[model samples]
Structures are given as C-alpha cells and as structure tokens.
Target: QRLLVTIALEAARVMEEGIVTDPREADVGSILAFGFAPYTGGALSYIDGIGAKLFVKIAKGLQKKYGAEFKAPKLLLDMAEKGETFYERFDPY
Candidate 1:
C-alpha cells in the first residue's frame, strides 16, 4: 500500500510538473524505467484496480496510524469524491 501511494504520488508530481503528458505514459515509464510491476498494469492501474476511494480510505487510516506520507493527496481525494477515475481523467482514451 505504501509502495502504491508512493508510486501514485510520484507519478502525479511528475505530471503536475509538466514532465509527462498522460498517466499511461507515466505508468509505462515508471514500470520500464523504474522497474514497476508490469503484471499489475503499472502503478496507476494498480491503484485503480484497488479502487481509489478504498485506497484513499485505507491510506487515511494508515496515515493516522503511521505518518503523513500515507496520506492521500488532494488531487486523489478530489478525484475519488467526484467519481472521476484517474485513467479517464488523465488518459481519456
């Protein structure tokens, strides 16, 4: 879970910096460049597969039990709240 959050946040940060165009590209890069799990369809997909809302909820609990690093980002929270999926928003076919 920590690994998932770390990868998702890192990918988001890179995208926010305008270093990447889409989440899929970022996922691919992270997988190939950083050796992320391809079987899980990269980090973003892994998060999606786990369900962002559930991930954020678990992350929040983990944050309280652990540290701030476990806290989900505002972007993720907002995305989850609106039922807006990361892949749909970031990639959009």
Candidate 2:
C-alpha cells in the first residue's frame, strides 16, 4: 500500500513539476495513460485527499520505515509547509 502510494506521489511530482501543464490533465492521463487506480483519484488527488502537510509527513514516515526511495521531494516539503496543493501550486490558470 505504502509503495503504491509512493509511486503515485512521485508520478504526481513528475507531472506537476515538469511533465504535465494542467492538474486535470495529469489526473486524466494517470487514468487513461497509466490505468491508475480510479478510487485513488490519481497521484495529485491522492496527495490532496490526504492534505499536502499530512502527505509529506506520511511520506517522511515511509522513508524511515521503508527506504530512501520513499523520500518526499523538496517541492513536496515546500508545499506541505506552505499548505499548497499541487493544483494550487502548479495550476496554469
């Protein structure tokens, strides 16, 4: 479960930071392009669902509990501290 979540989260980061321009597009692509879990609501949605702060906190725990592979990125840390979601931070509109 944790590994799956981490993969989703990192995929989200890749999209939000550079790959994709729109949050909605990323969410849609995750479903159509990767067949990601619909219930999880794609990577960004999963993070948003948990709240950025909580997501980072959980990722940090996972990092220690599992390995460095689960480490939250700097962007995540910054967003978590500032209470910004990926949509809020990366939305072009």
Candidate 3:
C-alpha cells in the first residue's frame, strides 16, 4: 500500500508540474494509461486525502529511503505550505 501510494503520488507530482497541465487529465491518464486503482481516486486525490503537507513530509521520508526520485517538487511544497489540495490549487475548469 505504501509503495502504491508513493508511486501514484510521484506520478501525480510529475504530471501536475510538467507532463500535464490539468488535474483531471492527470487523474484520467493514471486511470486510462496505468489502470490505477479507482478507489484511491487517482494519485492527486490520494495525496489530497492525506493532506498536502503530510504528503510532502511522507514524500521526504520516501526520498530518504528511495533516493532523490521520491523528492517532492517545489510546486508541491508551496501548495503544502498554503494548506492547499491539488484540486484546490490547480483546479481544471
């Protein structure tokens, strides 16, 4: 479960910051391209459910264990600092 969350959130961070512009697209790609489990509500939702600040902290810990690949991007850190979820911060409309 931890691995699943980590990979999913990391992919979300990647997409949110660069690969994709909208949260919906990111979530859709995770579901369509990777067949991610829908119960978690996609990767960004998983992080949002965990709280962005907590997610960053968890990602930092994961980065310690898994090297820099698990590092959260600056955008995530900023959003976390503001207590904003991905949907709230980057809503697709």
Candidate 4:
C-alpha cells in the first residue's frame, strides 16, 4: 500500500543521502523516528518481508480503487520491476 511504498521510498532516500548503511539501523530509525510499527520491524523490513513487487501491485490496485496518493511512485515501480531492494540501491552511511 501507500504506507509501505512511502516508507520504502523514504528509507531509500535516507540511504541515498548517506544517513545510514545497515538496513537494520534504518529499520530502527523508521520505527523510532517515524513510529513505523515496531511489531513489523520497520517499513523496510515490512516491505521486504511482504515483497516489494507484491506490495506495489497491491498499491496500484488500491490507487485505482482509492486516490492519487495511493499511486505508487515511479522509483518504487522501477525498483519492484527490477527486483531491486532498498539496501541494494542505497547506503545510508
């Protein structure tokens, strides 16, 4: 969904921005700073566990059913299509 995509993108940005390198640290920050469900192990973990491609597909469906905000960003779509994980593309540190 939009929530997952937003988290993933934000996590990616954090990594791209050289804020952190370890995904585990990113997850902790997301949960602590953003309050991203500690039970799910942060946004990146949630997306990775649920599968980015699947999440994007579901999000696209939601976008059609809901509104523009649900629309997955191109970066997400490209990442999903290419099977690229956030950590693979970004290094916060």
Candidate 4 C-alpha lDDT tens digits along 22-84: 788889988888878788788777767777798788777876877666666666677788887
Provide the overall lDDT of each model, using Cα atoms, as 2-decimal numbers: 0.74, 0.76, 0.76, 0.72
TM-score of each: 0.79, 0.81, 0.81, 0.66
Q: Which sections of candidate 1 miss by over 4 Å? A: none
Model 2, 56-92: lDDT tens digits are 8788788898898888777777888999887887765
Candidate 3 TM-score, true structure as reference: 0.81
Q: Which ten residues in a row have the lowest lDDT in candidate 4?
A: 84-93
Clashing pairs in 2: none
For model 3, the local distance difference test gives 0.76
* Number of colliding residue pairs in each model: 0, 0, 0, 3
Better of 1 and 2 by TM-score: 2
Q: lDDT value for candidate 1?
A: 0.74
Candidate 2 has its poorest 10 consecutive residues by lDDT at 3-12
Worst 10 residues of 1 by lDDT: 8-17
